[model samples]
Target: MGWSLSLLPPPEPELLDAVFLSAGRALHLANAFENKCQYVLRIANLASAFDEDPALTLDEAIAAAPSDKMLGQTLHLLVDRFQTPVPEEAVGLLNKARAARNFIAHEGASLGSSYIWVARADTLIRHAVALRAAVQALSLGDCIVSRWVSEIEEPNVPAPRSWDDDYPPMVDTWVFGHFNGLLEG
Candidate 1:
């Protein structure tokens, strides 16, 4: 059977606002995630170079680092070349985040038609939220790798502050709670 847009009520302004906000946030988060991946890759390369040559200065190690690569290739190098031990759950999340980032960058405009044609703003919002979560997970893994590198570089220094050190208690709890549910289920 065919349907008509006239049969449905106009989209609520509040819902449209939510959809745009969520999608924008997802895009920004995806950008941050990619940057974090690049950083992790760079640091991992530096650490590996230093491991191979103890006498290499920091500048020399940085100079010896591999050239920049795409996100997928960087991740592969991190695992296969640098031997970073990413947990399976984090690897799954990282892959999903990469796909979500690609979709947002390349095909997100297709979702705009659904906003009016099918009045499916909720679907758009859900997609954005999932993208945000996946990117967040990937960024968290980046943080873990960052800490590992920091420790390797400065083993005598005291443990550094956590990423969430400034977050309010409720927000911290909520964020970790969501991840716990995602991880356990």
Candidate 2:
């Protein structure tokens, strides 16, 4: 028989909000990388084809390149094709981003009924920073795709309107301070 883990309880609302936002941001980064990967591969392929035969068209090059792959596969192709060092850490961060996105979009209600991911706000912040690092690592000095990267601003980590005076509670001061330091650093 297969073993399984049981669910517990939902996390605090603020914690949930923070995770959802961070994961959503990471997902945005993931989408940008995915789109840029395809764009880069097509451009490179077209350039090479042009070098070989000037008759090749952009559409032909784009259709010829194997662009119908998943994001992870595209990242792998980047390494082999461009010799870029997308570290394993970066890949892990992307995967984390994807998982977080899936959880927020698909399993959000379920998350409210379980405690499997009772992570603190700082954890999400760290993940955001890691995603940025991954993007930085993948970018090239003079590549068109590098220029296609969608810039992400720092986390605002606050409600657009307002929260109650007791928001986040004074108990979370250490966490807020530590995460703020990570962002500043």
State each model's CA lDDT, in order.
0.59, 0.45
Best by lDDT: 1
* Candidate 1 C-alpha lDDT tens digits along 8-63: 65465454444455455546655666776777778778878989999999999989
Question: What digit string (tens of lDDT, one per residue) describes model 2 on residues 1-185?
Answer: 12223363434445455545544544454455556666665555566666777787777765666546665565456545543665666555445444543343343323333343464555545544553343333232112233323211223443332222222232123223333544547
Q: TM-scores of the models, in the given order?
A: 0.59, 0.44
Off by over 4 Å in 1: 1-11, 81-84, 108-185
Off by over 4 Å in 2: 1-11, 83-185
Q: Each prediction's Cα RMSD? A: 7.0, 11.9
Sliding window of 10 residues with minimal summed lDDT for model 1: 166-175
Where's the lowest-lDDT run of ten residues in candidate 2? 162-171
